[model samples]
Target: MKEKLARNINIYRKEKGLTQEELAQILGVSFQAVSKWENAQTMPDIALLPQLSRTLEVSIDKLLGYASQDRPITIYEEAYLTQDYYWGTEPNQACYQVLQRMPPTKPIKLLDIGCGEGKDAVFFARNGYEVTAFDVSDAGIEKTKRLADQIGVHVNVFKADILDYRLDQQFDVIFSSGVLHYIKPEFRQEIFDNYKQFTNPNGIHFLNVFVNKPFIAPPPEKEPNAYKWHSGELLAHYQDWFIQESSEIVFDCNSSGIPHKHAMTSLIAQKMTSLDH
Candidate 1:
């Protein structure tokens, strides 16, 4: 495993056109450490694996010499199996606001990542938008299909992981709420970059992430399913985009029926038209 990881690190770093020194600088490690890793003399710390894989644009499984397959299916499957509407049946407030402001003349293309039970996807579809919704859970996709059927709305639903899902078409609006935080911090930037590239000119992205806060309690040690973003992290990533709205708020977990305080950063930004393009 060590030798395989060493070879992969070398291959991926070279593929990115980064030298040992460059990769070390990006990872905030010494060049010698990078050299040692590639030489198979040592391995990166467990915590550094996520960042390393992200920098290489590879999955953790692939970086660790495991066969690249579907991401672990247990997490979302458990959620769907245990709860019908894990996040409730209504569109979130952020999504609802975006839907209300959508243009009426043209049919807008919308993609809902982590669509969960499909409430938001169906809501947009019913509102006359062409919607494509996807989740990692089979049950979630089925629930989405059922919801669309019940509402007499059409939504193209599929099962996919956000990390590896390929986007063949651009969208006018991309909505992802309470989902980005679940991604490893290193991979979040790649996801954001993909969303930006997949958005049409002047297209908007509605995103929200859990942010670190003093008052917010950490997820239980045994259930570390999500990562808390640093304050202003989302803004830092989208600094060049046209920010339509941005805010930080603390709210109770009404959807989960859990009386816990949650700190979140919500943002709506539009891709800017490039003059060179």
Candidate 2:
């Protein structure tokens, strides 16, 4: 908790474009105090939490690494509120890959990050994997629950911002699609490290990101939070892991009722142990 709080403080402070001294001034604390809090050497007094939360524009629970019951933070929340699933009920092709490569011969644990409307997560759960999924949109989480309940499968779905959420438990497989771009380039290392650290050895991560290309125009759904990855940039983080499949593709889209194209890169990597030869 201390570590998460410290990291969140630093992240939010930077995101607000404030230096240590600047934030300290706003909170009426010495710059060293803020630094110590961010370094995990000290924690702010309980009384200061409210003020700190307001200043950072974050909820107190979030500052302490808990998922606050705040309203949805996703641009697709409106679309998801409708009865129809915004992204549809069909699971991504990567879901099939995970099923084949790491079938739940045992009670395999899997995580679906940013599982918009729960289709992929539900698919995994129905196929016998123990699945936990989360997204930043309340509607999305609710839709996921509805899907699982309707299918008679269980999926532990909740609302969480991918940028602030960290894995605290080990999982056998981690899956994400069309969501990595929500993480800014600067915070990718720390977030990815957390993901990799909490993954059991031999765990698999099937992730895809929209890559910025000169030829392909951006999609019609111009999301403010979206940050396109550089071509081959996603592969750099998995140098130590075995890359089973790494490729890029140009795809068509009509999400916003306007035709456009997007380039995306996908990677399927498996964690390796030092003993693996």
Candidate 3:
């Protein structure tokens, strides 16, 4: 993992306004030890994990680079955390709000990146849309398939990295909620470029992602949260293929039930009828 553990730890520490020297003193370690840990040359021993976590003001799971949950639920916190309440309470309503608004005269073929737990997939498939779902986690893909089978719905599930995955088929709509924000900013433009190729004529794309608005704060940290985004920064990335249809930014909770009183932005854009890929 290229020693992301250390990198994550450093991110948390800096966010907490603690320097290596300061944190070292608190942990009863030399500044050099803290530096090595930050540099990924070494790791804190398991015995000191609890102390380290408390001193860092992060949960042990966060200190260890795992999800906040007791069990390592998903590799990424946003994956399941974003979906739990939405799925448990009003999954179909959530999907319908996005999908039904489209002009229904045409058949809809949909592609979902990071389709965790198949909540949205089930909603779409049951409503007679052809859906192709992708997730990087095998466990997620298995759960999607099982859910589809259980509901007597048909869906094609692919367990693959979204960054490397490509499709020969195009779709009338490509909807990825809580997935686009997870993409690192540098690669975001390239990722959107790929989406352009995936969209059929007159197709629409929907996205729900984090927005940077310091005035609207996020929930208390339970772990090393690696990414932050401003809505303006993220929208600039999609200007080429997405013309804003409808968008709203609101206070929302993150996947872990953390109070994310930040601007959660959602947009619906119709793909330009003609764009030479």
Candidate 4:
């Protein structure tokens, strides 16, 4: 396992165009320490794995040399297959409200992460935003493509896992709804880092993450899915950004036709523009 991790670290670092010295600088360690790890002479402390993987833009599972194909995909695939509109057909009210507030003359480039069935992507496309949407589930991407076609709107939809997804271009608005919590606790920060890096200056991020609350039921032992954030934990991640709106609310979820209370942290924040500009 140590050997595999060493090789993976080397590979991912090069993939990100980072030298050993550069990686060390980012991690606040000496270049020799980075070299020792890659050489398999030593292993990074367990606590550094999250930060290390985040800096490399890879998942902890991938950094440890687990088979990429072994990552969980079926649960989401089944969810999209079993339900016509799993979350709902209508776009979230917050999404609509944000779009209405955008300047009319500026062209918005939007990226919708975990865009199931293309509801919000299509809505944005129809509203004149250049939209790119992706989901880990192939079924979800296909459904999104079909919906976009049916609506006579163009949306670049694809299947991608957020943990390993590369951000080739920046976006004017990056929206993620009820998706961040689906990632394991360790990887959520890495995903957020990617979002911040790929968003254009002054761009807005609209996100909602599940949070633990007294009223919410405990996670099922058998399923073992979705990480719950502690109160105010999610907000702390966006402290440097210009917060436009934030709220924690408990609501009844009827998506599965089984009503259950859910706690979520919803936020809308804008990236800061360069002071020099």
Candidate 5:
């Protein structure tokens, strides 16, 4: 079913002419995220439905990938997600520094794709941006919402699949961290085509994705194939957009003690003013 969803997302996004990296940026994720979605190895959480619908210019009902009258979110999962998503640390300094460099604008509207338990969203919201956060899980949304309420701040939360989401309005900035490596390729392109439309002409986009590398864990002696990886050179395809900064680094994820399994490449690109493309 997840694979079917990935295929459909790719078809619609390409009919529109978007690149995987482009889609990941708009969806506030990494190119790998779009790849994953296309491959059907996993699914986006449910709360991102609204944003996904708006971004993709599709209906929420269609985005959910469900035809039956069933709530996209499950109760048990919601309980678990809400608790787990928020149990992590605060926003990283590198992320904060990048966001602070943006030009000032009134009523700054921001979107956080794959916003987990609202950690990143809450950070931006508290710092004076109007934030809209979405995830694929209902539990995640509930947890984010509850946390926001406790903190006396407001963050619009929803369940959505970014690939199929549609939006008429644009944003001032879009942010996603450690999120895009999951998206499948076809859908990533769709997102790129739409991202420019979703942001103000000069809007800034911050993205983080994995750099291609070999696996670290001891091979099972008969381990399956490792995933293919990509780099900034591939991003050159979208040269029209000013590639502000693209770099590779290694960082610890959670307390795993293992050198990060995925080497990361981060991109900070500012949208080109002209839409003559």
Candidate 6:
């Protein structure tokens, strides 16, 4: 939460054209104090939260890194409330790629982004990887925890929005499936940069994004914020990274009880600082 607060303060302050000194002056605190907050070294006083929120033009909840208590952002919330898992109890096939490549021979920290129902997150945990997972839905988080408990493995799962959640710790493997479209195009670079920065050296990221295709029609779910990626768009952002594998495929889906086809681009990228690995 401290990391979220710091990131939000910096982002909102910049959006409002305020520097550290200016924001400090408005909050009646030292510029050093404002800098400290943005650096995640310290936090603002509780009394100043309202004022800070007002000045930033964002709610206190947002400043503290909480998604707004507004309407449901994800349709799966209701579906997940059912007795069965919405997506299914099976881990994605991409999970096997990570397991085979990294093998968890040593302690490997893995993060399952948008871990719907905990299938993949629990899979990683059961494979001896320290796993953390998050999704935007409360029901999904509950299901994730329940699945992990039923499997006798622990997954540190919580609720998080991909747009607002920033990693404060490093991970060896970062995996996400069918969630990158939630990120607006303009914010993609910044978000990916943060993810890359927080990754350990030689860390791997396996991600798949729904791509816009001339032949393939859109899915049944009309999520409000989803923006389909252009073919190879995900790779353009990782030109500097070692692209271990990449492929584009068209697959059938029965989500929402409506059969449809989706074109997706999947990439396995590795971070490297030097040629000698």
lDDT of 2 by residue, 1-277 (tens): 8889998999999988999999999989999999999999999999999999999999999999876676545679899999998788999888999989999999999999999999999999999999999998888889999999999999999878898898889999999999999898889998999999999999999999989988877677758888879988999999999999999999888888888888889999999988856
Say which candidate scores most in lDDT: 2
Query: Which pairs of residues collide in candidate 1?
Result: none
The weakest ten consecutive residues by lDDT in model 5 span: 218-227
Q: What TM-score does prediction 6 earn? A: 0.85
Model 2, residue 80: distance off in Å is: 0.8
TM-scores of the models, in the order given = 0.72, 0.92, 0.62, 0.73, 0.65, 0.85
Q: Write out the backbone clash pairs for model 6.
A: none
On TM-score, the leading prediction is: 2
Ranking of all predicted structures according to lDDT, beginning with the best and ending with the worst: 2, 6, 1, 4, 3, 5
**Candidate 1 — worst ten consecutive residues by lDDT sum?**
218-227
**Cα lDDT of model 1 by residue, 168-225, tens digit:** 6799999987777666666667667877888899889888888889877864322355
lDDT of each: 0.80, 0.91, 0.67, 0.79, 0.65, 0.90
Give the per-residue lDDT digits (tens) of candidate 4, residues 232-277. 8777878889999889888877655566777888888889976864
lDDT preference between candidates 1 and 6, better one: 6
Model 3: per-residue Cα lDDT over 138-203, one tens digit each: 556676787788789999987655533545678887878766655655556656776877788667
- How much is 12 displaced in model 5, in angstroms? 7.9
Off by over 4 Å in 2: 17-22, 66-72
lDDT of 6 by residue, 1-277 (tens): 8888988898889878899999999999999999999999999999999999999998898788887556577878788999898788988999999999888999999999999889999999999999999999888999999998999999999888887888889999999999999887767888999899999999999999999988877787879979779988999989999999999999898887899999999999999976765
